[model samples]
Target: MRILVTGGAGFIGSHLTDAFLSRGDEVAVLDDLSTGRPGRLDPRVAVHQVSVTDAAALAAVVDAVRPELICHLAAQIDVRASVEDPAADARTNVIGTINVLEAARAGGARVLFASTGGALYGMDAAIPSAEDQFPEPEAPYGTAKYCAEQYIGLANRLHGTAHSVLRLGNVYGPRQDPAGEAGVVAIFCGKVSRGEQPVIYGDGGQTRDYVHVGDVADAFLAAADAPRPGVWNIGTGAETSILTLADVIGQVSGRPVEPGFGPARPGELRRSALDVTRAAGELGWKAATSLEEGVASVYAWVLAGEPDR
Candidate 1:
């Protein structure tokens, strides 16, 4: 099978690309290098430097590659940034996804959209959000992702495509850059490695469903092979607080971490985890990486000069 992964040079995308390649599928990448890195990609994969917002260029590439599946991962991922500039976020997350869908339509390809879990659920959502829960997103990033999912649903309905959405938890692993808009795991690893204290926003009590990038890659692969087209949340179905995460990183680093406090960023969820029962039942996918083990990998990666590939 030939596969094209947009943003395939980034953290989660890079790992997903490797999963496909290891399975003997021909793989290509489309990344603008805005926040992605070429060094993260394998030499065997063909790399295209283009943004999904450019519809014509995206369509041309899709037509040329003619992949059997397109895993859509390119998006504006920052929640606080989205609050500051929603239109830009929508342009990339919403419009960019539309371009991918249209491009996929031209070649009769399936799409697997990467969506957010906690951000999409917002404050009023159930403790462990299920696929049926309504999303009252606090930021444009989540709203745009949900809107993009809607477009995918529409495509499936109007054009009879098998496009699906995978709402991911807070994904972290080796390739996630510490300096970029990384998750708490990478950031904490960077801080601890540098002998600096990680600053926790709010009271250090906010919680999230932390899932490893490798597990996320597996979830996508499972979704790709599944016969049904639907939405699934890829997470561990467990919540770990910021304070606990800091301690976990400290434990992994063989040192005690003392974190500083700061005001919580707007649009941040207090406590969120995904009820992944559906994913397990439907796709036979579940996160296998324990938080401690996952944190150790990041800590090791940070100590190793953060290699790109």
Candidate 2:
């Protein structure tokens, strides 16, 4: 199969590109190099330095590649940044997704969108939120993702296409940028390596479903192989709190971490997890890496000078 991965030089996208290539599939990458580094990608893969927001360039690349499947992972992923400038976030997350879908239609390609499970649900949502729950996003980032999913659904209905959406949990693993607002695991690992105390915001009790990058790649593979279009939550179906995560990191690093407490950030979710039962049943996919094991990988990667590959 020929596959095209948007934002393929970034953390999760690079890992997913590896998964597809290992299986003997042809892969190409489309990235703008804003936050994505070319060094993260394989030398053999042809990378088009194009942003998804640029419709003409993106369409030209899509038409040239003519991929059978497109894994759309490009987006403005910062929550705080989205709060500051929603139009910019919408231009990338919302309008950018529309461009991908439109380009996919022209090339007769199927799309697999990387949606957000952590940000999609509201503060009052169930512990393990299901796919059927109403999305009450607190920030523009999440709202933009949900709005993009709507376009995907509309395309499927109007064109009778089988594009799928994967509502991803808080993904973290090697190659993740520690400076990013998200990817708490990577940030914590970096701080631990530097002997800097990890800061806890809002009592350190807020929780999230931190899925590993490798497992997330497997979920994409499973979704690609499936013969239908649908929404699936890719997560561990369990919640891990910030304080507990720090404990796990400490254990992994073989050091006792005394975290510094600070005032909680406003508009943050207190608890969040995804009910991945549907993905397990339909896509036959489940997160296999334990939090301790994943955190250890990130720590090792950070210690290794944070190599892109």
Highest-scoring model, lDDT: 2
lDDT of 2: 0.94
* Model 2 CA deviation exceeding 4 Å by range: none
* Residue lDDT tens for model 1, 146-228: 99999999999999999999999999999887876548889889988998888988998889999999999999999999897
**Candidate 1, run of 10 with poorest lDDT:** 175-184
Give candidate 1 regions above 4 Å deviation. none
Error of 1 at 143 (Å): 0.5
Give the lowest summed-lDDT range of ten residues in model 2: 262-271
C-alpha local distance difference test of each model: 0.93, 0.94
